[model samples]
Target: MSVLIETTAGNITLDLFVESQPLPCFNFLKLCKLNYYFFTPFHTIDKDFSVHCGNPNYPNPPNIISSSIIEDTQFQDQSLSPYLLAPKSTIKPTLGTFSFVKSIHENQQVFDSRFIITLSDSFDDSLENQVIPFGQIIEGFTVLETINNTPIESIELKRPLRDIRITYIHILHDPFPDPNNFHPYPLEPSEFQLSTMRFPELSKTTKDINSDNNNEYNALTLELVGDLPHYSIKPSPETLFVAKLNPITTSESLEIVFGRFGNVKNVNIILEPKTKKSLCYGFVEYNEQHEAESAYRKLSKGCVIDGRKLHIDFSQSVR
Candidate 1:
């Protein structure tokens, strides 16, 4: 069953499995119908294997769902036991997983919503039924990937972490977060945590980088790793990557309007981190080198944004 899970960035379509694990599936579906999963999160995220959501608390889980630290996937002579509430293994978690920690006694049964999803791909054996793949992501994986790449400094752990935030969720017949309000987080989490979309160029080496923005104009560069927001990996062009224009003229709008005239490959808006403002400029990446020149000659004049005539041109060299 595919259901629409809307996020602030966009809507992620999901395919729910009703048969694999009935209890968790029912719980998940119930939460969906009741909107109990609204404004929740899949906090434990792995870019390679999976992304996990489903903490009990609004922002955090009250207690880990699996109380008893039982065996997960390593038990020998194990028959495919079909019905259990929590996971009974120690294996590292994977994507699309909804495994609950289980107990050795089988009496200490507990289950909450702590779950994960697989962002890491290209592994055959890693995701071998270890995690219960209850539902699949449809639309918002890109946005979700962006979130997974966000770098967060763990003041507590004294390390960095992937920025995972859930702004809203609609679960059925489950307990809603707000007793007063009818719906969950209507605004998307990304709207609140904008910085998390792209991986920070400056990895969290020290606390001051996160605290102070105006440290120095260090060129932000990083090793390509973990949840990349989008496939933005082309080398910076020799020409500058901005198009000066008035406010209200968006990069997307320009791409749509001008790209039709010729073989324009792509459009990009360069944004300033602190200000969150586009630098009043854009990039028109054409499919062929010649197409860019021709389009620049033809369409660079009288571009209108917010009724303001704009100047379109090649940007500074990106090195």
Candidate 2:
């Protein structure tokens, strides 16, 4: 099957093997459809190497599509004819990518949220038919390699240049490739380019004071406290911008506040059971983070929202 691997930089086509990794394929596909992949950057990219992504505590619950490991006629047929297959190495080099990661258990599969790409060009005979080869990147190897090689730290591995990120991810189709193995089209940009028309300008005095006051708009501290993995890019609608709100606020209030900042595509306010009150913290989705951050700030600090003073912050609102 075909899907797109999106990062903050750009998008690349990933030709996945639904026939082989049925569950992982489905999960990846579902996540893509939910536009979950568009903004999430592979926090750990090993240049011309492997690209690993998916951190559940991401913008959202992380649209992870899972299934039981079952073999059907589709995936049962396996052949080693494919030129690009995951090869085993003393250490799997970040090349000729695979949708997996180094986990705690030998056979444990917590990596359903994490996938890797290979960088090695030649496949060693030792790796022949040993590991599952799901797919290869159809395009943007340079961009992918750049991400892998970038100097950063991995939230999971806690290593630099390990955790790369994309605002979000999406999958598009070209319908011109072979059905058995399609080299899918690259997913298009979800971020909208605002047209610059005759923009409004004010006096320098006003501008300077407003700029200073804008900073005074009140800042919320998000020290990346949670153990949840951080993305190369923050969450947004088009990106991985997950909205957080207080318990007392209703969905309508969220939409009103967030929708006003930008075009809010979806807003979901999670609530606690039994009492059925707002969880005080839920996800708000915007087409971009600029909009989400704007909303978060506007609605924070007694902004006269929902007939009450709202306490908004990035640290999970952990009330």
User: In model 1, how large is the Cα lDDT of residue 252?
Assistant: 74
RMSD of each: 16.6, 19.6
Q: Per-residue error at 265 for model 2, in Å?
A: 24
lDDT for every model?
0.45, 0.43
lDDT of 1 by residue, 174-193 (tens): 22122222233222222222
Question: Which consecutive 10 residues in model 1 have the weakest lDDT in total?
Answer: 67-76
- Per-residue lDDT of 161 in model 1: 49
TM-score for each model = 0.39, 0.39
- Model 2 agreement with the true structure over 1-319: per-residue lDDT tens digits: 2644444444455666555454445545544544434324444444443545555333233322331111122332333234224233333333555655334334553334455566666445454334445567755565655665566544455334323344334343222212232232333222221111011222233345444453222111011212113312233323222222344677787677667778876666544334555533345667775876777766654455545444444322111
Q: Evaluate model 1: give its TM-score.
A: 0.39
lDDT of 2: 0.43
